[model samples]
Target: MSPERFARINQMLDNRQIDLTVCLDKVHKTNNIAAVIRSADCVGIHQIHAVWPDIDMRVSGNTASGSQQWVKTIKHYRFEEAEQAFNAQNMQILTTTFSDTAVDYRDIDYTKPTAIVMGNERDGTSPEAIAAASQHILIPMIGMVQSLNVSVAAALVMYEAQRQRQLANMYGTRKLDHAYCQTMLFEQGHPVYAKACRRKQIPYPSIDEQGQIVASTEWWQRMRAPDPQALTC
Candidate 1:
């Protein structure tokens, strides 16, 4: 990897938010999904959770403009599953919806570990998602249209979270754990070799000062060796 590339990757990982995340509940539109991913990446969110029944949760590359590649997306078959996963991480779920009880999006304390949940474009947030949410939030609208598009709504709320986090200096320093930083750096810088190591069930080779793989000669030789299982076949 080039020094420039390594430096960029390291810088991004260093500012990544480990606590903040986004969740989509039954949002099937690929374009909207991609837009949300783009916004999430801009705010240094490292992961996004998506729960959809039938549609594949893959982001549209064209719409995402390569932003999807920078963020990890976890898809769940059910909203319950997604809720439980985030809950386990101690993240408070805040679903965006129109409700009498819902509070203004800006009123919430976003500096805490939080996951902003967005719903389907047509049907709005799922009942299960609403029920599971610790708090309900909504963007104020004065026009005839009651709600904004899913992606736009997500971007609005996410940026609010980013703003609050920034005020708290969350983006001013390294927030990622040491091990995660190294792992992401290696994967981003040497994707081919990272995949090779995964396939061969071997640990990743150490990266040198210039971001070049150390002991490349020995590692490549081992990687090229035929597998014993394949030999039996």
Candidate 2:
């Protein structure tokens, strides 16, 4: 990897918000999903959770654009599963829903560990999701339209979270694990060798501070070996 590229990736990794994320409840549209993920990457969100009951609704690579390389989309078959995972993380779940008690999205304290939940394009947030949320939030719209598009709503909420966190100086330090950072550096910086390791079922070698791969002679031999399964095919 070039020094410039390595430096850029390191800068991004340094600002990642390990405590903040988004959860999609049956958001089936590929375009909307892509837009949300793109926005998430722009705001330094490392990953987003998605509840996809229908297998066909998965995001396509074309729709995801280049942001897919940086942001991870974690899939879940059920809302309950996503909810349990979020709860275990101790993140305050904020659902985008309109209710008597629902507050303006800007009013919430986003500096805390937060997971903003956006629902499907058609039905909006599921009742179970709303019930599980620590608070219901909505973007105030004065026009005839009662709600914004799912992706638009998600971007709005995520930016608010980013704004609050930024003001509190949350973006200054590195929050991700050291091992995770090294893995990302290798995969993104030296993508060819990273793919080679996967193809040959060889474990990844450690990366040094100068963006160089550090591997033993045995590991190198394994990486250079042809894949038996690929040869047969």
**Using TM-score as the measure, which candidate wins?**
2
Candidate 1 worst ten-residue window by lDDT: 52-61
Off by over 4 Å in 1: 195-202, 223-233
Q: Tell me the tens digit of each residue's lDDT in model 1 across 177-216.
A: 7777667777889998788788778788777667877766
Error of 1 at 170 (Å): 1.0
Error of 2 at 29 (Å): 0.5
Q: Write the per-residue lDDT of candidate 2 for residues 1-233, one digit (tens) a residue.
A: 99999999999999999889999989888889999998999999999999888666656667668888899888888888988888888999999898998999999999988989998988999998999999999999999999899999999999999999999999969989999999999999999999888877788899999999999999988887878778999
Q: List the residue pairs that clash in candidate 1.
A: none
> Residue 84 in candidate 2 has what lDDT?
89
Best by lDDT: 2
TM-score of model 1 relative to the true fold?
0.88
